[model samples]
Target: MNKLSIIIIFIVCLILFIVLSLSYTKLGTFDTVISSYIQHFRTRPGIYFFQCMTYVGSIRMYVPVICILSIYCAVRKKLLNICFLVFNLWGSRYLNQVLKLWYQRPRPDIHTLTTATGYSFPSGHAMNAAAFLGFIAYLIITEHQLRLWQKTILLVFTTLMILSISISRVYLGVHYPTDIIAGSAAGIAWLLLCILFHQRFIQ
Candidate 1:
């Protein structure tokens, strides 16, 4: 997308984040109900699948990919791409930490299917996955030469990747749906900001 479109999206996401944050703070009935509903549909295989996806979204997985990508970028001397990637991934992570602290929201009090310890206003996995995959999708769609089908597949895959990771966080009982929504908004906002800045000043 173009700069204007990205800016608009960023604004929309920020607005969404604000709305969700408010609802979450009040513990909206819908939030509680949906959280229950999502957890209710859980199956053994589904748990395994999402757990694996959550692992893929984890810092453990992203760290190596970030290192390898950064090294390749360094070797190729692609400074702009390197900066954008780091900002979208690593910087977004650090920003999420600040946000979690600022909000000081607590995780669910239910029995968790997985373990995670942190204030859970915004899910780290959800944010990081959104930022990383959103950036990759932007790069692929804008910088590459591909057929329409190829672009469609990439977009679809990116969407699924983001959705799966976010849903996993909720399903695992570590995050509420609002937390994931807020996290996604925060992540995509940062990603779009980086893309817009990179385009205007670096490109």
Candidate 2:
């Protein structure tokens, strides 16, 4: 998509996040019902599956990938790409922390299949997945060497990763559905802004 379209999506995501934040208090029923519904499908195997998937969005998992990508960029003499990659990933993380602190929303009172700390209005996993993986998808799409079918496969895989990580939070009973929604929205907005900046100035 063009930069103009990216800007429009960014604005829409920002608006959606703001609206969700403002209406959080009114979402108690929605959150409870959805949480219960997801939890109902929880089995030992399912929990184990999500536990593994959730780690895909974790710092420990992404850091090595980021380092590898950064080194690749450096070897290719694409310093700007390294900067963009680091900024997009780390920036999304910092934003997630600030929003969690601002909201201070507690984790779900339900029995959690996994351990988590800190506030949970917006899930860190969801946000990081959306921003980091989403940016990677953008990079893949823009790569001229990749065939159209190759790009499609990579994008579909990236999208599945993002969605899996987001849903893992809810299934594990560590986040509300709205938390995933808002986090994804905020992360996507930030991702689009970064892309727009690169297209307009860095490209």
Q: What overall lDDT goes with each candidate model?
A: 0.86, 0.89
Residue 61 lDDT, candidate 1, scale 0-100: 91
Q: Evaluate model 1: give its TM-score.
A: 0.93
**For every candidate, C-alpha RMSD to the true structure in Å:** 1.6, 1.1
Q: Write the per-residue lDDT of candidate 1 for residues 1-203, one digit (tens) a residue.
A: 77688889999999999888777867667678988999998999989998999999998998898788778778877777777887788898899999999999889889489889889989888899888888877775766689999999998999999999999988888988889989999988988887887778654
Best by TM-score: 2
TM, every model:
0.93, 0.96
Residue 156 accuracy (lDDT) in model 2? 89
